[model samples]
Target: MKKIYLSFLLFHYCVLLFAQTPPAQTWYQNSDGINTSVKERWNEDENGFKHGKYIRYDIASNQIKDVYFVKEVGNYSHGKKQGEWIGYTCCNYREESSIISYQGNFLNDKKTGIWKEFIQQDFLHGTNIYQEGTYVNNVREGEWKNTMGVMLGDGTVRTYAEASTRKGFKTIYRNGEAINAYDDKGIDLIENDKQENLNKTIETEFNNCYSIENYKNFRAKYPNSDFDSEATIRINKLESEKQKLILAKSEEDEYLNPLLQKWDSMPDTSKTVTFFKDYYKEFPNGYRKDDVKKRTDIIWNYYDEIKSKYEREGEDIGILNAFFQRYPNITTPSLDEWLESKIEKNASVYKSQIESLISKNTDESLKLALSKLDVINRCNRLLHNSYSLIFSIQHSLLNWKLGNTELALKEINIHKNDIVDFSSGKEKYSSVFKKYYKEYKLGYPNEKEVWKQILLIINQ
Candidate 1:
């Protein structure tokens, strides 16, 4: 309970200290600075350049929160510090107690225009000991009030001794030196000014920018910068990755569009014909979209009508295969499996017929093999049933070797090259190859012979 109460007090104290400074955000690296220990704590723009309000804190101190960096913040443009910046002397800052140290305008790294410097009698006591006049380019000019109490810019008059400031004198200044000494209270503070650092920062500028346009802009602005060569290399890498994503999306659409189209044709589809009509009305010149008219139950019923004619006569695999060749894109897994089964059944019946004619060495068995090969090529080849089609190819070739002159060399010529695509090493291709091999086999093809024939066609 004591630890919890102490933590609540510490949280509120730290919040008051950083109220004018950066809130509870994160810190990043600024490797370009002369001092290695100074860290930049700010957000970056698209090009990895430090943008917006920036604070550079000294991590050299061992303390968890350094007292000097409480409110010393400035604006950063193109990763360079610019505009009005406030600097503080060391230790804790409580608004009622902490005095205003030195506030001024910075042009990159150089101090310019009016500035104020403070001397505190006691640290964090909110007391200003002395003052100086206006400055033009790091030098003092005009009249300066030499009072014991410092009249703060926020209409607060404060001194270590309460009523001792009303009886002070004035001093005149030229260049950076004082012409006349007014009193012995405040010492001359003109030579105590620190050097300000500012210039184009994008010019050790990839932690600099995460976007291509920002890197390009950096290159354009600082064409002769040392990082220009590396920026060009990064741009090329980003572009190459972008093109690879485009090609991958195109391949995905090729497989996906048919599934999407077939799915949309169903009556209970989530986005049906009415959805497309609404979309077409919204985007008249939409990509690859054409005018679609409303249709009734005629489409799916008509497909079923065609399917009926082939399967009615005790499942004619040849005519059923021709139906698939005409409408290859529309079928689902159930329909594809059904057709492959029909082909396997037909092939089994014909295999026995061909074996009976082995002694005869006739053209009749050759013609039967050639006809079955045509049916497999038209139907299963679309889905690339490698084992099924490979069996048909090797069987037709063996029958041709038996001296039956019913030549159809086109089956061997076409599929030999095309079947190699199924060996893509994807699980989908591997599953299809295994499925057909288990279901049907006429002339057995070993792994080596199967791959050899598939590749040999490519070279030819």
Candidate 2:
């Protein structure tokens, strides 16, 4: 009985030990169907959580043998990264040393405490790149020093012997905010000292007799300074006083000199109302004030004149182009609104005239009406008018009326092709065009050949 109990106890103990041990997993670094090397090896618990040391290898090929440089070695607990982790980059397995990219501790999968980054100088040497201060919950805390290197391309060379010499800025950050910065010679780059000197210069200028030029010079030199607004206000007041004194002395030209110069530089073709309003404000009683007011009036009247001309003359491409060129700043939608009204009216007139001609059924009258319609269509196209269905149906009807059977068939076919091409993927037919198409199709049943060609083109 004693032997039997002991055997049972030993079996239970073996089972527990086997259950505690994790299963090993191996991964390979393969490229282009070639198994370069063993990339990673680690162990996971029964829960599928990583629970042991993880190892990564950088694979490199050489004539003699395949090299596996240890790239990262770290520990994990229940799939959460924990404890010390070290990472290397730009490494050579055949050499004695490698570039330590980062070395630090991880707590519950978050980086914590100080971390040191290094620039690999050579196979056996590395310079400290930066020293990160302590981190709390992965947020950097306290002072941190980051050193920059002079060499541009990542401080690495193929030979690994001629590495970049460190010559660059050193910035100091406190709690993630850069507090101080300096170059290689240790000159402070935050410019607090320079600002103090600039402030002194501005104070000296202000102490002298009030001069507009001095204030202007100060503003130009230190445009971003805290005193900039104060300098600007002083300059404005002095200039206003000087202008009043010059006007009082009956030298009105002195007051108008700058305004006249600005007006002379204005573009000859088009000027906005706002430009003249500003001129009027600057020189309300000057010699050219009336002229500026007249220019403002002209600009305000220009849009109205163009609108009236467009309304009276119908659609004219030349007039439309001239309106846009003159009022380049004006938006197209306003013009489009006006033009759309005129276009609708023209379309109505054309439709009425075509219908009247079709009812008369006299060839001479029909021919004259067709010629007028053709001219109208040409003008509409030149103006970028969008009445496609009306134009197509007009051409088809005119051809059918003249007994040009093939031309009428071709016109309807073109219209169908356009509809198919335009009505793709979420695009529905235009309501106006759809209505016109239905009317033409139903009204022209006697012209059955043209209708058949249209149906065939649409179906195909």
Candidate 3:
């Protein structure tokens, strides 16, 4: 029963101590000599720098004030300290005491760099060091630890490893020990082994920023130093690829309008009709689909005019019929496929028939047909599926006129190349195509090939 009562009493006392709020400190006296007092209006001390202590004065209130930091002892004007004033930690209306003994080096009146404090054994209670501080007004204004407390910009008063601030929270620490600190999520900010490495790296980089010269030198010395280097390289590469994509977009916009104009003006010849037919197949998503359809409708209207004029009309007519027979799925074969199938066999016959109707046909009909041919050329370059059989045949025809007879013949035989080599486009077809386009270029190897080769470089 006695033990239980003792435990209960101890718990209550601890709770009271933890909840205790220290009273605010007052400016009671100025050993250095700038006057701030309940007796007088306080003002800025102009001689603060010379005296080494800034403002000083006293509070006469009955309420106990916190500790005051005094520099030197003497009467000072302009609210500054004069000769040798000592610093003390006073509490309970100045009845309690804490003081540092100073000797040796003094720069002006302030302690230069390192000053050691000696305390009575009773004050330390078995420990070598003792420290404490308090708040005044909304600021963390007070005499701190055994050492002069440095007022942190964060509004916290620093006294050795312990700190208290405007927020009214306190932390206590032993001389040579560590603690795991956590945020609201219970995430350990310092001692968690899993994320400690990442945290340290981030902290180092952040601190490096304040030391610009050292940071730059470190980066120059180690180009691929850490994750930061890899991220920098990736961002640079992405920006370069984006620039290339922008240039490709500008090239695509150039031929769109002129091609539409040409399609509006053509005559219904086999080549003109075939051009628009392929144009639609290649560019289903093109802006000119309606224009191609309109031009196609005009051709059937004039179909009868050519039918009656030639003795060899039947031969040309058979070719058109063959196109329908071969591609039953094509509802619209722009050049009457029947006419084109017969063109080579009945070329001389069709020529004579065209001559007979030359005077009767409008010049607009001939001009429009020529324009349609041009539109088809531009569409094939920009939008066609160049790997398809029809595109290969067209490419062959175009290359034949450009005097590249070898490439023209190769294009016509693309199916044979695909059959002989299982790799097709990647191996046989690409080899043939690149020999003409890629090999001739300087300083730019096929990067895909180079990467593949690099992987196999160490193979036995």
Candidate 4:
């Protein structure tokens, strides 16, 4: 019982010792040309190690000028720092306008978990040096983000602002050693500044030209630039525009050549209905469609005059022949048939006139004769065999009169096979002109034999 009582007294004494409050303590010192002060509860463990909250400050200046301020604020465990800690700098002793330098968790006097470190350039701007990842047993592990920034002036003056204009990079750390640092484009952040400068240079060059060759040259110089994709898009657009311009120029040139060479210098008399007909047939959707219409009106007026003259004069062979001569590809069947009957009834008179015209021996005269024969054949709607035979015979006769036997034979041979092919078809007359076949046959009974003899002459 005495031993139990003595144990109880000893236990009460131990409780009193453990429950005593530690006195508040303060200390001041000068270092690095600045005065500093620390205040805390002088609590200590049995081993005489500090415990509980601790605070520190630089008192050299009420405003932060050259000295660090608010150095640390954190708790302690058996003299080792632990739990959340904050280290910041301030311009005032009252902690006004303070810059948080570091803030994060601690364990046994070692930094652990997420921690951020900042650099204060001025009162309002700061740079985040790093935002580190988790710490395992005081060793940095996993990813960390780092950033850097610079102050921007407003041309006339400078002002402190939040350091939001920062470019960031990611670094992988293992045991507090960085394994890799890279940006979003996978370019090494260590070399990012150099690459960024190069990109700016390329952009300046590109903006000056905005051409495909310019972009292509940029790619050639900086093959690994971050703006490669953008450059490619620009090149495609520029090349497409270039091709469109080339095609437009080609179309313009094509339309211009024929206008200058053929249509511009055509004679008034030559510009009959046939001239407009051929023009529309060749250039149906020409760029000068309005001009084509205007020119066509001129030819139509001439055609109206010819038609009126023919109706009033009752088929003067000379005037009828002249109209047909001008437009060989055109046919007026009734007018052509009336002229044909007039020629046959007065063969001597018509032949004399034709011989006089032929005596000139010009290309225009030859073309006119060929044109008249073509109109006659078309008006009569001759069969393919009969039409070819009659046209060839007439063409050959004209060439014979011109003493061009070789050219006449050349023309005959060119149509020889076509004539043979048609004769084998058993239709001696064109189906559309079957009613006129008897008159045609009577005019040329031995046309096939005649064409065959001409072919023999040509082959010889």
lDDT string, candidate 4, 38-132, tens digits: 43334567787877766665534544454433556678889898899877565333323345678889888888888877666454333346454
Best by TM-score: 2
Sorting all predicted structures by lDDT, with the top scorer first, yields: 2, 4, 1, 3
Global lDDT scores for all candidate models: 0.52, 0.59, 0.37, 0.55
What TM-score against the true fold does each predicted structure earn? Answer: 0.26, 0.37, 0.23, 0.30
Estimate, for each residue in 318-389, the C-alpha lDDT of model 1 and write its tens digit.
776656555555444565566667666766565565445433445565456556656655665433554455
Ranking by TM-score: 2, 4, 1, 3
Better of 2 and 3 by lDDT: 2
Number of colliding residue pairs in each model: 11, 0, 25, 2
The residue-by-residue lDDT of candidate 3 on 120-141, one tens digit each, is 3333231123233332221222
Q: What's the CA error at residue 374 for candidate 3, in Å?
A: 36
lDDT of 3: 0.37
Residue-wise C-alpha lDDT for candidate 2, range 1-460, written one tens digit per residue? 6534533453454344334432378787787898756777788988998887887767566688665555776899999989888886644444423356788888999988887666654543444564445666675665454454221122221111111354455445554444555555675554544555668877776566369998887778778877778888989999999998777545545555565567567664545455554545655656656655665566557767766777686644334445555654443456556755655566666667777775675778668667656645543432333454556556666666677667766655554534312333322223333455565443443556665665565556
Q: Candidate 4: which stretches are off by over 4 Å?
A: 1-23, 30-42, 60-69, 92-95, 126-129, 149-164, 190-460
Top model by lDDT, which number?
Answer: 2
